[model samples]
Target: MIRVIVADDQPLVRSGLAMLLDAADDVEIVGEAADGQEAVTGAQQLQPDIVVMDVRMPVMDGVEATRRITADGFSRNPDAPVKVLVLTTYHVDHTVHEALRAGASGFLLKDTAPADLLAATRAVAAGDAWLQPAVARDLLAEFAARPDPRAPDAGLLARLTPREREVLVLVAQGRTNVEIAESLFVGEVTVKTHVGRIFMKLELRDRVHAVITAYEHGIVVPRKA
Candidate 1:
């Protein structure tokens, strides 16, 4: 079963999410919190597989909660690291970016379809990253526009092989592993291997960071919309 802790300041939001997730047979709502601090405490105590976190909260906020929950040595289950999926009301905001940098595995709009939200939670719990395409594009554009963003680390990028480099570019372009496999005329497993290698070689924490690094390094520039 995929254990989960739902955190939101609003009681209705918390109850609604809990109800929706509880309907899934493979998922269990192990805990619920009204604020970010409670979410962090629940995570440390319950050691759930995933935390459905609200970006804005009364205490501490989701970004700091995510950082604390995902920080090394905080989670007792090191083998199965607790993943965070942040929900936000706004799109392409700084809080979303902060949450990602703080170790959130995915970001979704609160109004996302119930099925998609469930899928995102499951995907993150399964050690994969998820992001709404439009949000991701806008977020990357915002990041790229920042003044004096860190220069691309050519030395770190040099660690990747040519194929891994291709994979990273595709990933930055928001292509899923399956799409990348089909596009490259390779098997999905091959694409997965290439992605894993790309993450390892680049020292990326997850796909969100991989995308950020790709943008920062100019491997894939955000297209002007």
Candidate 2:
């Protein structure tokens, strides 16, 4: 079973998520927290497989809590290692970006259907991530409008093979790994491998950074097409 914790300041929110998740055969709502500090505490104590964390909470906040849980700590154990799924209502521009930067494995909007939400929780627990499409579009727009002032790591870009380069461009275009697989006429596993290699070669933290790198390096630009 994929054990999970729902963390949100609102009681109804947590209750609703618990309800939706409880119905899934593969998921169990092991715990719930009404604030960020409590979420962190519960995470340390319960050690659920994935944490569905709200971006805003009364104490400590999700970003800080996520940072604490996912940060490289003293011990590494399968039962207790935490993976965070940032759940939020906001998707204006940098909300999703900030969550990923804080080490969240993935993101989902609060309005997401229960099925998709459950799938997102599962995805993050299984070591995969995708910002919701709306979230991705907002982020890409912001990235294109005001390119990060800092320069891309050119050396990292130099390390990618031509094929990997093409793959990354699509990734930067906000295509999911499955989409990239279809586009490239390869299996999803192969696409994942290429993505992993790209991350390794670029020394990138995750797909979020990969997208940023692709744009900041002028490899992709905003297009209405």
Candidate 3:
């Protein structure tokens, strides 16, 4: 089963998520926390496969809690780190970037559809990152607007094979693995292999971080609307 801890300051929101997730056959709501500190504590104690965290909370915030939980490797088994999936009421631009930097596997708006929320939890638990397309677009745009003080890491790009770099660029462009395969005239398995190599070379946690790296390093620029 995919164990989960739902953390939100509001009781109703927490309970609602628990209720929705509990209905899933492969997911279980193992615990719940009302604040960020509690979320961190619960993660350390329960070691759920994933934590559905709220971005803003009293006592502590989700970003710090995520950093502590992920950076410290505070799961039941240190080798198997717990994943955090941030939940926010607003799509506050910086919060998304900060949460990822703090080691959250992914994030979703609180008003996300019930099915999508459940799917996102499963995705994070299975070691994949999830970001809404609109959120991804906004994040890329935000990164583009900022002035990057440091130059792109040429050494990192040099480490990737040419095909791997192509895969990374498509990923940053928000293409799915299947779409990438079609674009490259390769099988999905081939695309996955290329993506894996890119991640290994770039030291990225998931596609979200890969997208961020692409934008931060100017590998891919957001398209104009």
Candidate 4:
């Protein structure tokens, strides 16, 4: 079972999320918190597989809670750190970037479809990053507007083979492995291999990090809308 803790300042929001997730046979709502500090405490105590966090909260915020939970390795296994999936009503660009930087595995709008929420939670629990296409596009635009201060490590890009770099660019553009395979006229497995190599070479934690790296290094730019 995928254990989860739902955190939101509003009782209705927390309860609603719990109810939706509880209906899934493979998912269990292990706990709930009404604020960010409580969320962090709950994560440390429960050691859930994932935390469904709200971006804004009283007495702390989702970003800090996520950072503490992830940094402290609040999970059943230390090596496999706990995952956080941030949910917000607004599409505030800085909040999105901060949540990901604080180790959130995914970002979703609170109004996301029930099925999509379930899928996103499951994906994050399974060690994947999930960002809606619209969210990814917005994030890329935000990054383009205000580039990350840290300079891209040139050696990291130099380490990737040409195929891996191609894969990385496609991933930054939000193409799935299957889509990339189809576009490149290669098998999905080949795309996955290239993706894995790209992650290893770039020291990326997941696809979200890979996307950030791509933008940071100018491998991909936000396209004109």
Candidate 5:
């Protein structure tokens, strides 16, 4: 079973999320919290597989909570690692960047459909990244807004072969692994492995950071006609 902890300042939001998740047989609503601090405490106590976090919680807030959780899990090996999936109502571009930097595996609009929410939970729980297309666009805009020129990590990037470079470019373009596979006429597993190799070569924390690095390095840009 995939253990989950829900964190939101609003009690109703927490309860609603708990209800939706509890309905799934493979998912268990292990705990809930009204704020970020509580979320951290709950995570420590529950040792859940994933945290469905609200970005704008009272007290420490979701971003900080995520950072603390990830930092605590960091060692030679992360023990009972917790993956954070940030939830927010407003598409505030700046917050998305902060959340990614804070170590969230995914950014999700709170109004997301239940099916998508379930999918996000499964993806994060399964050690994969999830990016809502709308959220991805906001992240791209955040990357684009930076004043410095995008500079590729030339030394590290050269390590990737032609096919891996192609996959990274598509990833930077906000394409999901499945989408990249379809575009490249390859299996999804192949695309996933390529992404992993790219991350390892670049020393990236996760796909979110990879996307940020892609933009920072000029491997990808915000899509425009």
Candidate 6:
């Protein structure tokens, strides 16, 4: 089972998230926390697979807690890292970006459907970044609007082969592996291999980070509406 910790300042919201996730066959609520500091403490002790974190908790914000929880696992066991799935009432622009930058694995609005929430939890626990279409669009727009975006890591980009760079661009474009394979006239396994290489070479956490890198480095700009 995928162990999870629900963390939110509001009691009802915390209970609701816990109940919603615990009902899933593959998930179990191992713990709950009323604030970000408590959430970090619970995560360290319980070592859950996922943490459903609220963005604006007292004592410490979710972003800082997320940073602390994920920081320790950076050079440790990648397979067992405690992934965070951030939930918030705010629009998916600055908040989402900040969470991701702090090592959150997935993001969703608080009003997300129960089914999508479950799916995102599962996805994050299974080592994937989950960003719904709306979130992705808003994030991309936010990045595009930056008058001076952070420059891409020159040495890292230089490490990618021409083909890997193409794969990264497609990934940033929100293309699935199947679509990328079709577009490149390659097999799905080949596309997957390319993606894996790109991640390793760029040291990206997941596709979300890849998309951010692609945008920050001017690799793939948001398309004109």
Q: Which residue runs of candidate 1 sit more than 4 Å off their true CA positions? A: 147-152
TM-score of every candidate: 0.91, 0.83, 0.88, 0.89, 0.85, 0.89
Clashing pairs in 2: none
Candidate with top TM-score is 1
RMSD of each: 2.0, 3.0, 2.4, 2.2, 2.9, 2.4
Estimate every model's Cα lDDT from 0 to 1.
0.86, 0.79, 0.83, 0.84, 0.81, 0.83
Which lDDT tens digits does candidate 3 get at residues 1-225? 999999999999899999999999999999999998999889888888899999889899999988898875466686568889998888665776778777888889888899999989987776666887656677677776773444237798799887887888888876888899999899999998888888788776667677777887778987776
Candidate 4 residues 11-70, lDDT tens each?
988999999999999999999999999998998888888999998999999999988887
Across residues 74-174, which tens digit of lDDT does each residue of candidate 5 receive? 32247447889999898665676677777888878988999999999997887667878765765676676772333345798789899988888887765
Evaluated against the true structure, the overall lDDT of model 1 is: 0.86
Instruction: Please give the lDDT score at residue 74 for candidate 1.
Output: 87
- Cα lDDT of model 2 by residue, 1-225, tens digit: 999999999999899999999899999999999998998889888878888999888878888888887777711573446888888786573655666667787788899988899888777776655568765755655666666555356777888999999999998876888899999999999999999999888766566668767866778975553
- Highest-lDDT candidate: 1
Cα lDDT of model 1 by residue, 135-219, tens digit: 7778887656662244337897898999899999898887888999999999999999998887777767677778878887778
Task: Give candidate 4 misplaced runs (Cα > 4 Å).
Answer: 72-79, 150-152, 185-187
Scanning candidate 5 in windows of ten residues, the lowest lDDT window is 144-153
Candidate 4's clash total is 0
lDDT of 5: 0.81
Better of 2 and 4 by lDDT: 4
C-alpha positional error of residue 138 in candidate 3 after TM-score superposition, expressed in Å: 1.9
**Which residue pairs show collisions in model 4?**
none
Which candidate do you rate higher for lDDT, 1 or 6?
A: 1
User: lDDT of model 1 at residue 64?
Assistant: 95
